[model samples]
Target: MEEILGILTQLGLTEYESKAYISLVSLINAKADEISKNSGVPRSKIYPVLENLEKKDLIKIKQGRPLEYHVIAPEISLKNYEENIIHNIHILQQKLTRIYEEKLPHVNTPIITVEGLDKILKKEYEIIKQTKKILYLRIGFILPSEIENIKKALNKLINNGIKIRILAVEECEIDGKVVSIRDIFEDMDVEIKYKQLPSAQLIIRDYKEMFLVFAENSGMSISNSNMVGLFNTYSVIISNYLSAFNKQWSKL
Candidate 1:
């Protein structure tokens, strides 16, 4: 009984509606006073609530001196809910089209140069966490030990179903998930094609939003985020660079 009531609520039936319907189902063709008592709702509220249930098409009202309510079966009530969901989605589509037609671009470039050591790390960590597909990492100048947390983020991305490709300089050690990395590159799931650049560090998402971090030697970055600045929507250029990079690297 509780399970059925729970499912009814999950399907968007109000508390009063589910109780009112359930009470009518057991009593079968009940008037307001009887339904109010069985449903634990007060007499004054039962009639108006029943009106709502009828409007939802979950109940039928037969008028007499006092109106009697009948509960529609689950199959019929659920069909109403399914139709309601579709109708709501169609309405949302229309609303979205109107907003898109009216929306305008902002005047300023949406870029920020973050400062401070911990805040920098936190920001970079956050952005990496939000990545959905593709983390192209190439850290030739920095030793594996220097980029531990960043690599951890990369590993986390790969495990969470984000396709990853690492273009390591042939000499660099495999710092994270070597087997899964090989699995992705060997098949089309993640094509990791690398060319040896002297020292070009890059991390990108969807080949569209990219970050090119310069290897700053001899200074421990006080803030991780402060060290890196993002350049957005340069994927065409990045792709062309990756193409040239891959073409040269694949020669081996």
Candidate 2:
């Protein structure tokens, strides 16, 4: 029953409301006091929980001697909740679009210089997080040691429905987590491209934005002076890079 409440919560039920509803189900018709006793919620809190459920049409409060509450069937309540959530999401999205239109600036160029490896990698994580379109990555030094953080970033990107294209550097052999990532990307809608590259840790987000990172040494250096630049524009140099990537993509 506890696990069932959790499932209901996942479907967008408030914890108290779900418990209240489930408690109501165990009775032919229940009052708030009975619901509180059965559900282990205090009587004081159960009334509000019942009221919320009643407002959603999940329960009917019969104004009888004791005022009994009856739960509507699961199908009805679930559908009602689903539709409510969908409607709420649409309304929220409309507000978000208006906010974005007002707040976001139109940019002229994409150019930034990154100094330290840490800063550059942090920038990489940010771009991945903010991606709303596509992400094309040509990774030559995707070391196994750094796989976890990279995977975490990519997972967040993929979850947001971003289109992902990845070209693994042939020299950067990997296993375990890397292989798991490959399998995930291949299976999901994310596109995977493999290549043998010499250098250049390249990330292109939505084609219009690009960044280049090259390691100064074996590990991502801790040099505070090292910086990674985020550009709102791409360069002609990126055209050459894309052209080569396309050629390599043809082989696979």
- Leading candidate by lDDT: 2
Q: Put down candidate 1 lDDT per residue, 1-252, tens digits, no spaces.
A: 888789878877788878888888898788899999999978888888899888888788998988878777858776876899799989997889457433412122345554444554565566566576666665443433336676677668767889776675544323221222233334344445544454435665655455555433333221122254444444455677578655665675
Worst-scoring 10-residue span by lDDT in model 2: 218-227
What are the Cα lDDT values of the candidates?
0.62, 0.69
Query: Each prediction's Cα RMSD?
Result: 9.0, 9.0
Per-residue lDDT of 175 in model 1: 28
Model 1: per-residue Cα lDDT at residue 170: 41
lDDT of 2 by residue, 76-99 (tens): 777877898899999998899668
Clashes of each: 5, 11
